[model samples]
Target chain A: MNDLRTKLMEAARSHSPSDAVPIGFEKQVMAQVLALKSTRQPGLLRAPVDAWALWTRTFLRATWSGLGVVMILSLGSLAVPPSDGDDSDYQGLMVDSIAMPIDETGGEIL
Target chain B: MSLLPEPSAVPSDLELVHAVRSGETERFEELICRYQARLFVMARRYARREDEVEDIVQEILLKAYTRLETWRGDAPFEHWLMRLGTRICYDFLRQHQRSREITSTELSGDEVDWMECQALPDGRADGKADAARTLVARVLDRLSPASRLVITLLELEDKSVKEVAALTGWSVPVIKVRAFRARLEMKRLIERLDREKYL
Candidate 1:
């Protein structure tokens, strides 16, 4: 096993790749690097809004949510029926009464 | 920026790194030229094709460039670069393993002959040496990526277990286990080849 291992190592060391870097390889790599640099926007330039923008964004978001709450409450109010306290009492009184005497001449319940 | 440093006044790796970090981007080319050959040699071990080797080297360089600011200049630049290169190689091996199935294909007549030659006393001849390398590559292809990497570092590169650990960031025990497993795997592969050749 040791002998085989040694032989394998020997073989590996002896073998070398035949491939060579093509001509102008460095030039090509540099060109690519330069192109990448040119296309990249500087971080400072890209970050135009800064802390002020963050503050504005947060304020706008808060305002929108507050406005949404108000709108929802208004809609809820519209969904409910309007009430007069006296009307409820009157309804209750009519429901409770079984019968009332009739005024014969006027044909009205008193 | 002032006039660029003259070629005669070649800067240290750390200085070059600092220059590149401080907006003197052109200095990066010097770093590339300085390490290109060594990086190419290291990359070739993992990549079978020329194009693949070149691609790996380019990727390594680009990564080094983008992460230059992270280097603390504590160790030699080459040492850090070597560790990075090994990591890249390991990743490539893992990806390759995932994408391809390991087939137990029969060795060709020439390959069988090469295997047989390795056992002979005079197998150190130039031609047989080449065949041996080809056989090693084929066998390595059959191994799991982890096993192949362990074997390459332990056996082929003659790295100590500690050194392998340092390069791979694996624990010493893990490196030892992987090395043992890799040797067994390689032995089985070679034995299978031998059996097939005889049959």
Candidate 2:
């Protein structure tokens, strides 16, 4: 197996494609480069070229999400009971706050 | 007066790259003319069809052009370009791996004879190098993409493990491991071919 492997490697080393580069290959590559240059932004300028597009996309997404959150909050607020002009609720809250326990150090006990 | 023209100093690859980056795009052709033949030779090893080789070369060149900025000047430009070329060739191998099947019908009579010649006592097959090459290519086809890449680099290209690791971005130990498995895979492929031929 080792000998066969050596022979195979020898053959591979000896074998190379005799064909040269196809004629006009350089022209084809040059043409491609030229076309690419026309479309592709230079490295220095690419970031700026994409900046506006990226900003527009980000801004639009943020606007939609903000509106969505607002809509959800508005709908949620509608589900909650509205408070009447009554001092009773405030009076009960004030009593609860006064009745809460406090330690000597002024930290609330858990 | 002698008819011979004066020898002019050619621009270096780094200089040409700088020129292209500085908006002198035409200078890129100098780089292409300098390296295209070498790239074609490398691509030919991975792809048999001339058209496929051409496409691979084109892709490599275009990629080099687009990513030219990423090439730090610490290394030689040829090394950078060849590394890119090797990676593209590996990708081409993987992309075409599914379509490149090694069937019995693919081998020619000479290739079969070459395979049989291996079992002989002397194991000499003169004037059948092409057949050996074909057989090797077939066996390589049977290997997985990573195996094929490792074998091609280690054996066919005569690259050292360190060099292969550098070109492939694989660590030295990984290249060593892959090369060992690749050789084993090649041996199994050749044995299978011989068995099928006998049966």
Candidate 3:
């Protein structure tokens, strides 16, 4: 194992492949450097936004996201339905607000 | 000797960097011209294709330009540039390693014979430096990115542990540990290759 390791190291050190920078590489870099900040935005916002196109794209993207949320919530609700089953307090509040008749004095009926 | 007064002194890398930061962006081009070749050589070790090498060099230069403000003058500019270049190459290795699939079929005839010779205790594979290099390269490619980076620096580049640590921003013990694991990985890869070839 040591011998193989030594041999591999010797072989790697012996392999000296030299590469010359491609022609115009410096110019290419300089060109990019000069345009770096300007190119970042890509002029996307400069173009006029068609209201219909904007809505269509928004609707398409939102469709999948909305569907995903709905599916997750549906599955979650099914997995853990309200199993405590103690709703008397909640039912009383609803009945009082919807069914009770109040006098002008606002006192409870005797 | 007709000595013309020495040609205009070449601007130091720091001077150019200062000029660049002072809004003389054109001076950055000189830095590019000075270091691009060295950067390409370093990048070529990680990337085999010419286009990939070019992209790596371009990224290093662009990154250096943008991050010039972060460089304190405590270290030489070349050292700083090389450290940055090393990190970029390692990143490139990791990103590309995912897509690089190696197989026994890719081994050349020379590489196979070379490996076979090494399998024997007394056998010697002389005059096959190219084959040895190919085999080593294949083994290196199969290694994880961290292992590949460590082995390349510690073995192929003949860097000391401290130097490797400095280049990679890793601690000395980390470098030592990685070097040990890298060697083990290489051994395993070579053994596997040998097995698969015969099987």
Candidate 4:
């Protein structure tokens, strides 16, 4: 029995796992897991409130979403294309109003 | 390396999971540090080459991260990792078998007896122990990866059938059958060696 146990332990001892992962393996794994979050659709809100009622509510939401698509399509058709007339003012300027650089004097913004 | 951490490290594996879910990185590192050895042990049984085992373990770690958002946390974290490791090992074996890379070498007494001596060390016969140990390692190399895994985990690790079944995703019947066949094969090898007057 002692021999058997010793044999078993010896054979088994070779199976011990090695330790040497990236210093921050958990962070890396979590980062990958977090990436999966974007692909996951959020669970239904107030899921199946009352099976029949929930079905009706979902139907309504679908109708609303379809209507939203139609509305955007209509609005998109009404928009005008941009004109070249606005390009001259910005092309001649050394800087734009929102993006001025600090001057060497530090007192002035150019 | 030390097996367990100091008692004051923090909370349980679940607490670490909660931290991970809350987007804290430290808890996740703690979780990995906590499990790396256990995972390596699991991976060792699946892969034939030590390097390959390490690779498989790293792949499993990557898989765990990618699949973790689905964790329901209804079970222990170690249990989940155990299951993951088992499944990964099972899949690795299945893939290897499917690839048809089985070695054609015949089993010999030198391999079996040496393996027995190294592993069983019964009362320590010191004169030839080193030679026996090497022979045993060589003989083990002759076994199929799946056989090595089942034998190591079941006979050596002392994991129960239910635990193995759960970890391996194999129904209890399959694990039983595989373990039974693996042991029978080992016994046959030993008997053959004895008949050949090598023992």
Better of 1 and 3 by TM-score: 3
Q: What is the lDDT of residue B128 in candidate 4?
A: 47
TM-score of chain A of each: 0.35, 0.39, 0.33, 0.28
Give the interface RMSD of each candidate.
4.6, 2.8, 6.5, 6.2
The iRMS of model 4 comes to 6.2
- Cα lDDT tens digits for candidate 3, A42-94: 43123344689999999999999999999999999999867687799899999
| lDDT of each residue in B28-92, candidate 3, tens digit only | 88999888888988998888889899999999999887777767778999999999999999999
Clashing pairs in 2: none
All models, DockQ values? 0.15, 0.29, 0.24, 0.12
Model 3 chain A weakest 10-residue run by lDDT: A40-49
What tens-digit string does per-residue lDDT give for candidate 2 at A1-110? 77787898899889766548888898899999998998875453232245679899999999999999999999999999987779889999999999977677768565
Candidate 4 has an fnat equal to: 0.28
Model 4 reaches what TM-score against the true structure?
Answer: 0.55
Model 2 interface DockQ: 0.29
Ten contiguous residues minimizing lDDT sum, candidate 4 chain A = A40-49
Which should have the higher TM-score, number 2 or number 4? 2
Candidate 1, A34-101: lDDT as tens digits? 66667762641132245788999999999999999999999999999887567888877897674655
Instruction: Give the poorly placed runs of model 4, Cα more than 4 Å off.
Output: A1-110, B1-11, B22-27, B97-124, B127-137, B191-199
Model 4 global lDDT (CA atoms, 0 to 1)? 0.60
Residue B103 local lDDT, model 4: 28
Worst 10 residues of 2 chain A by lDDT: A41-50
Q: Worst ten-residue run, lDDT, model 2 chain B?
A: B2-11
Any idea what lDDT model 2 has?
0.85
Instruction: Pull out the clashing pairs in model 4.
Output: A6-B119, A6-B120, A7-B119, A7-B120, A17-B40, A17-B41, B115-B136
